[model samples]
Target: MPGKRRMAQSARAARCLGVRSRPGALALVACLMGVPEARAFDLFGLFGREEAPPAPRPDALPYAVRLQGVEDDDLLSALQDASTLYRLRGEPPPDGEGLLRRAEADATRLVDALWGYGYYSGTVAFRIEDVVLGGDAAARAAVRAAEATRNRRLVAVRISVEQGPLYRLRRIAVRDASGRPLDLPARLTRVGDDEPARSATVLAREARIIDQLRAQGHPFAKVVRREPVVDHADRAMDVAFTVDPGPKAALGAVAVRGTSSLDPAVVRSFIYAEPGDPYSPEAIAGIRRSVTRVEALGGVRVREGEALDPDGRLPVFVDITERAPNLLGVSARYSTVDGPGVRGYWANRNLFGGGESLRIDADLSYLGLGQDYYARRRKLAGIETNGLGGRLAATFVKPALFGTRNDLLAGAFIGREVQQSYLSDAAGGTVALRHRFSDTFSVQAGIEGQVGYARDVLGRVDYRLIGLPVSVSYDSTDNPLDPTRGIRLTASATPYPSFLGSDPGLFVAKAQGSTYYALDEDANTILAARLGFGSISGAGLAEIPASLRFFAGGGGSIRGYAYRTVGPIGPFQLPIGGRSLLEGSVEARIKITDTIGIVPFLDAGTAFASSLPDFDEPIRYAAGLGLRYYTGFGPIRVDLAVPLNPDKALKQPPVALYISIGQAF
Candidate 1:
């Protein structure tokens, strides 16, 4: 009796379905009791910790969804998603004639479902037992009368679907205002004949076409019309978009608008979009970066002329808003090895009003009571200095120098530093010219003069060092601090002609390069490598100041060795400066997540006594693993390393610890 009553309730609900689609409820019922299934159920929803809905009574009706000639999983899945009956989850039961109403509505829904899959023509047939309710007026009347029964009864309904042929693109084209194909190529979007004719995909293609035209010197390009014609007979579609790409234009006179106090010519100096050059989308986008770099402007916008002049050129317009002239800023950071440090600076962005800037920056290292533990505990005999020291500097920058794309930089510095076998107190002045070739390349040449008193294994002395430093570099890394791709290369040649309180003049030549390659586009995993070499000509290592000579080891070099410890050994069993230095490193950077990464690395090379690197002497090797936590600026690195061939004479640490910002290379 109980089983019969449950069947009756399910049947009654099915027969009550109607032309108005109630998909969730109908689909749930079909899945539970009408679909071609063999005794599957949610027994009290025990697995998900939920209770199953009540079962249908004996007199309730049931329904099923049966497909015919629909083999495509994509089309079949889309149909199930679009169908109201198939969409039903655990929904409430329908009234007496609900099944008839839902069945009538499904006819239109099924057609739209087919169109989504590029099938314009489809067939949906619904029936109650042997009575066909599809366009057969006589059979439909009979089913309607049966479903109107006052007494509780059982019923079964079937939804037979025939998904028709998939439609595809037949032809597509673009036209200009005069109904003629423009001179410019319509090559951006591809409406391949065999591809599915999805409306969204076609619209996206249309948008890209208009964008491409505008970016190609057509500033007033516009898309006026988009038309899609569907051919059901051939199962194909033809699409087109009418565009109005105005005449091509070149850059004309520049106007610096909205500036009341600043020099108008200075804004022109910053503009890379010169007269006679083709209009550029990239140059417009680069305005934000350029404006933010000088820290002079608070807000700015670029506006272009609406129509071209008789010269066939479009004028460029720039509107400006200024920021506060003087700014004061301070920063502080703490590290176990370097101790806490603070840096403060005062800057005037518009000192001379021609984009001139003056900045006075000072930094104090060794803040608080934190000291360099490892260096203090195990100081070499001749090395009197035991902790890291401090430095200070001030700089002046003059932009638009002589109306040329060059910056004149002049700076002065005073500093103290403690190395493994030496200590230095130095003050110096420098004047330099920095020229930019492009956004990613530059060259700097400077004349520097310095005087210092140093104490090393060779004892303390006051020394003079003068040099003409010239450097050229190329950098294309996407991120300045945590680069995943691109290469950075720098070559420098500094010739020092020794003068007062100095030995022989020396020409120091050095070159260093770092390269990174990401395994995938996401750049989660990176392979990084670096190589560096330095040579001192015209003098020996001992002839120049110890501070200027070449030395290796340290966190940026052979990590397991102490600072300046990778070169030739000298007095007090400490490593002395060398004439030649070489170093190389390779790392496999693995990102565990967005904010965390791990690195395994190997380092090799050493400082040599000869002018050119000599292989006769042993090269030091260090291998290690590092951990990285990314910040808004870059990655913070912590590494542990061990030296393969440590000095057998002295007691050495088996492992060394280092902490810093960015990759080791």
Candidate 2:
């Protein structure tokens, strides 16, 4: 009987706690009964008390906000923005007390906002339902009366602002920590006299002073005090800043922390700072960037010691967090002209623990789609139409090689490329050393070797090749995947030695640049432009390998024409590639929503028969519209393009569709 009574009590308690199952109720009940404090719980509270149905929550009150006396539109808007009562009018407070409390807080906020806008003597007053809120008691009574009104009509809430004459800066002064005046350059303290006495400007001047001192080797410089004296009669403000420039110090010993499974020596190699060098905030920033370039590092923070060391240098510590070393990813793309392609890659970012990266990639493409149609149209022979093509590549990079700002790069690849004009099977490898001059500039020089067999309109040929490639690049873009501003330039040259290849080797050179400009501060609208030029010399078009020739017109190039179909026409109306190339594009990227965008673009370019672009040759033009679905990593791009001037002889398609990732550039 006792057990049965306990079970019943448990059921009742479970119902109060919103538990549905009997087993759950029993378990909870047993636990509660076993505890001494559980005896204090009112088990019979729900049943013993005569409780009426709870009243429904009242709906939000309807109210209208009115502003008066402040004629300046900017000031009026600021006052409204600072008022909590105006912002949250629809969300009615619990009662009259809540309403009064909100109004009092809004008064303080409005006054502070006025001060920020150079109106130091501004006044704010609030009125509700024809009753001015003067004192606490009077304001409370008025709010209560309004709530008790029977009529459901909208309540009136009014705010009046009186902005006095604007306060102008009379003088500005900078002093040391001991209150002694320090003569600083006028250009360094840019907040001039007679300017509006805005609080933000005063604070900014103080920060600039400290930054200037730090840049001059004062690593511990900071603002010790800031004083602003306002004179009501003169309608003027005088501001003074007291800064403390601690001991001038140099960079002390650098240390690394938070390393697990990562070689600390490898991390130290990325730091460009040396002991006894002048302590510099810029140098600290560079150190963080260098460490972050390591794919194995998840996060990096550089901390300076609070006090200078005995050697009169600041000790620097780099804290790094390591991420998982291995990664696997896959990507796919499709185009009406190029058909479909998929690629997969495996990467080990921290291979062998020395900030070395190794990646292996495999790709497959051209799964028969549109192959037969193009083959029939071009009247090509001995080409592998509708056959699958693929490539396997491996790349390795060792950062901070030889304890310098240089990296060792190596790669090898074997692939079969099937295109409208050529079918080739090639295997190649490259070794390179890249030196970084700064965050935005780099140079690379490499030696490459290749062996391949190709079949085209020129017939089958076997070739062995060796070349030296050199390149220089500069990038100042804020984001690589979706840049909103800045410019990127790249130039490269490769010379194939005649003795190393079966045929007479040639020299190739190319240069390309793109720039981005944002129309708005948030970068929702962007204007981007790109230009490219390429040339090949020292060999006739017939003698050069087909895969090595300059060919334009594809999703990555002209967009409207099919891949390898935009150059000089050879036998059977197939493009034979070219010796020179020229292309340019411009687009306006406009974001319609956070995750959706539209771009209208124009492209103009062509391949030339001669070694340099011949101005006499007519340029091909294409126009298209693109849709972008923005994601965390980048934007997914879908483009629909059409050739503006289709050559009737070539019989090119009127339109082309491309689906891929990232911008066209």
Candidate 3:
């Protein structure tokens, strides 16, 4: 009776509000009359009033993780890397159910990771909110209850690891495919008894065995089977490999492919292997290197035939991709003391259908307003007014000359150079035979002749000269422009006999070397150092041409000083050049970002008046900082240097600026 009376009253109220037939009118009237149950019902929702949307979940969920019970850093790191829950903690699952699935998957992955590191009996356990996963249903229910109350707050996840004693290899065996013991050298199989039974080491040993057989003229060598047995009681593992080494063979016919605009004869000439010779991997690699060295070829691939020829010999093929025949490029540089310079070059990689290259270069310098500022400031008495200095040169290279490692190199150059010390106009040519003993080492012997007019503080003179130049160089660095490891060394001597020159002749000898050290694995930090020495003998300083004398101050030598200003000075404070030179530099290259780096460097040494460096003479010192913007080709460098020990008499600048490409060394 009471329920009917209340319904009637609500209907009467809805009618009074002029909405008696509306579907939600009763609810609205109940809300206005302060009924608690009616207040909980949403009148607006019933009438199509849109409710506010739920907030978006974050891309990465908030969580806390802990790893426990592993003392070995390497093992711990490996385990973490293998666990999806640890690696992808930021990307949490959408719900509690998803998280449970992830936890279960991680257990299997972590155990496999441990086994790879020789921990065959390792175990992993995960706990969420103090409830162990994979436990009874009640435990899972507790975890879910906890998750439901988290309100998107941080959830605690813990991983407990128990790594048992490391398993060691008890026996290792290598056999033929027939299960008969093979007579392979023990060193070929790197695994040994009592060593940790790491899966990687076992796999690598199999590869090593196969490689040894192939290197010994077995082209069809392969590993037929690999078996490992683990004994948990003994905490040891036994491994065995069965190999199949097919019949030994020699090298047979060689063919060329993919040569378009390249002469087949030229490609054949670079092949160091001859038919009937024993098959060798090194020989194939050498042939590939030779073909790749030709600038006209962009890609070179050497492949062995899948099946031996009827003669029971391996066949080889050389595949090549040709590059454009002609190339043109331009480069620019600047320095406060040397002004700005620009260089341009054009090259023909394949001339006359052979691996011959011809290149022509032209360069111009002293294009800035401060070209002669240093000379004028020093009040040099006989220094010429600065003008555009330039050079024009052409070079040609004929590779693999006369079917040998020797290359024929020839070049001619004519140039006008205006320096603070002197001015000269000269033309010369050189012809040389360069022999490459290896990729990292080479030697050259050449004859050169020059005719030039030079003017310095001593006055103007015309001279003719001829000389024999010999040099040896070794470079093991990884990059020519920006090296991070290895060393580069060069030694050269050129002697001009008095009978071969209009003026008294001189002998010049020089040696220089640089080395790089990577301070970290990624080569983000590097330490580099360089040293150079030069000497002029067989003539007095005044008797030799100024261009032949040694001078040590410039962007290439001791930075932070004007060009040629670190050597002996003659009358009117003008550099007279020197008979000997010594210079050195050291720098620390540190990368702040992937494409940006900073270098702090120190440079020292100078030229002396004697035929060798005089320790008694004071050496100049400079220090600077540099900025580098790394690009695909190389680093673009900008340096600001200051002289540590300034010579007031020479009026050196407070700071010097240089902008160029490549490392200082």
Candidate 4:
């Protein structure tokens, strides 16, 4: 009878306060689980017109939770971080019984979570009850009263914690295989308990300590023990590790497997470890990357064998899976100037089964079926004969020819090309030696010869060309398709001999460099820039054929100008090319999401008649914005740009649009 009277009074109080009318908010307020009684409140959820979900029919508590006695921010935060129930705090469609179940789980994990914060004697007192009542029997009576009316069923969940004491620092010891103390870094051997202890973090550092031992010539180093001792009464913890720094080892011999088509020497040549060299996992990993770089190799595994040999050296095992020696590939792209292009290649990754590679490729561009060409004064008809171009080339590569990461390349090519203001037929052969100093650096030297005929603005001309080209390059970019960091540089010099060509034996050199930096933590926003330059010495503009000289405008160059139309022009208003060139580009690449991005860019460049770029000619500038649809294959690029300096001679609109793949640079 007393409980019944109390329930009636509770109902009357709820009605007087209008708590029973508001449903969601009032139910939440009644339960101390949402909008704590002593805290400020937000009115947003309260003003919404959406009706609160009806409380469940069964006798259940409203969903609300409270924590008590956790005052230390670190302990409180860590406890919350290690909780599954707290993470569900904002989970929608609150259910009283669900939170009750979760609170029970949080209670069970109290000790494990507190151990990290050095609370060895931590205790959790958990409870769930009808939001209005102070005792269990009263809570049951209230639930029965609510069940009769089918009104809100709010439950209050509380987890009161008593954190005994903060543990202090204890010795962390490292012992050698013989159970004797070894001198390791002091930081690795001792840690203070001022912060919470997480097993994963503490254990991962142990691995790094062992790796350091192995890096210092202990090839067989292994962690033998990890013991964390906790003292509850004294409020302290101590940890120890036993390491076996086995004998100093050397590479003994290699056991090769998975070789059928390729010669075993092909793989051996790439292994950096010599028979007596110190065994380093890092060196072996470099070898692995090098060997796997070959087109036909996959699934490479390199490791030290089971046991050290009697000679105090470790045997090496190399297992490499070989892909088919031959492969076929095709690719295509589209741009306003060339319209659309398609290319195909047949490659022999292991031609002679000794890591020799070869490829035969052909491409047809300038389909001229899409956009209209505004070349010179002529509005050329669509897909005309003069717009078509094709080329065929073959390349042979002999890897490890000079040393590991070095290759000898021999290639020959024949092609017919129709560019703005010119038609040319050409054939060439090249012999080159390339060496990779590291993953991000390489150097190449080559000699190439060509005989070609061209119909230029200066009329038909036939010539033989030969030159020596040398280049050094560096790339530290994180991704080829979407670079967010690092820099890429390629510098080359080609000096034509007096006897090779009729252009007064000019020497040409050019360097191009680009940089990328991420502007956001997610690396979805980036700032990129590029600088390029080319110059020719010992030759005049008239002596150099239009085909060999530089021009600064196109889809890959200055976007607002016509193809090959940014340099000197002859009487016929056709591009005559130039002896020197300078180009600059900058872009802000901003990502809207994982698969969509926008880039606002500016490009400025000039080609000068002078042998050296001197800014003597007008520098054409363009500003543009692009939309990018990022895909696994690559970024599909669409751009709109307009010339900063408008000219009628450009023979095109103030605006030009381009569609292609990859970045403009």
Enumerate residue pairs that collide in model 4.
33-64, 33-65, 61-155, 62-153, 62-154, 62-155, 116-197
* Model 2 Cα lDDT, one tens digit per residue, 358-406: 9999999984645444566334465655557899999999987756778
Clashing pairs in 2: none
Candidate 2 TM-score, C-alpha based = 0.75
What are the clashing pairs of model 3?
A: none
lDDT of 3 by residue, 518-625 (tens): 999999999999999999998777777788788877688888987788888777677778899999999999999999999999999888889999988889999999
Residue lDDT tens for model 4, 505-580: 7788999999998988898899999999999888666666667888888778898887778977765566777889
Off by over 4 Å in 2: 1-110, 126-160, 163-219, 231-238, 245-250, 275-280, 367-373, 402-406, 436-442, 484-487, 501-504, 515-529, 586-602, 623-632, 635-642, 653-660
Clashes of each: 40, 0, 0, 7
lDDT preference between candidates 1 and 4, better one: 4
Q: Candidate 1 vs candidate 3: which has greater lDDT?
A: 3
Estimate candidate 2's alpha-carbon lDDT, on a 0 to 1 scale: 0.77
C-alpha lDDT values of all predictions = 0.69, 0.77, 0.76, 0.70
State the local distance difference test value for candidate 3.
0.76
TM-score of 3: 0.68
> For each candidate, C-alpha RMSD in Å?
11.2, 14.7, 18.0, 12.1
> What TM-score does candidate 1 reach?
0.68
lDDT of 1 by residue, 384-497 (tens): 553557788888988768767688989999998665566788999989998866556789999988888876666666667778899998987767788899899999998877
The window of 10 residues in a row where model 2 has the poorest summed lDDT is 16-25
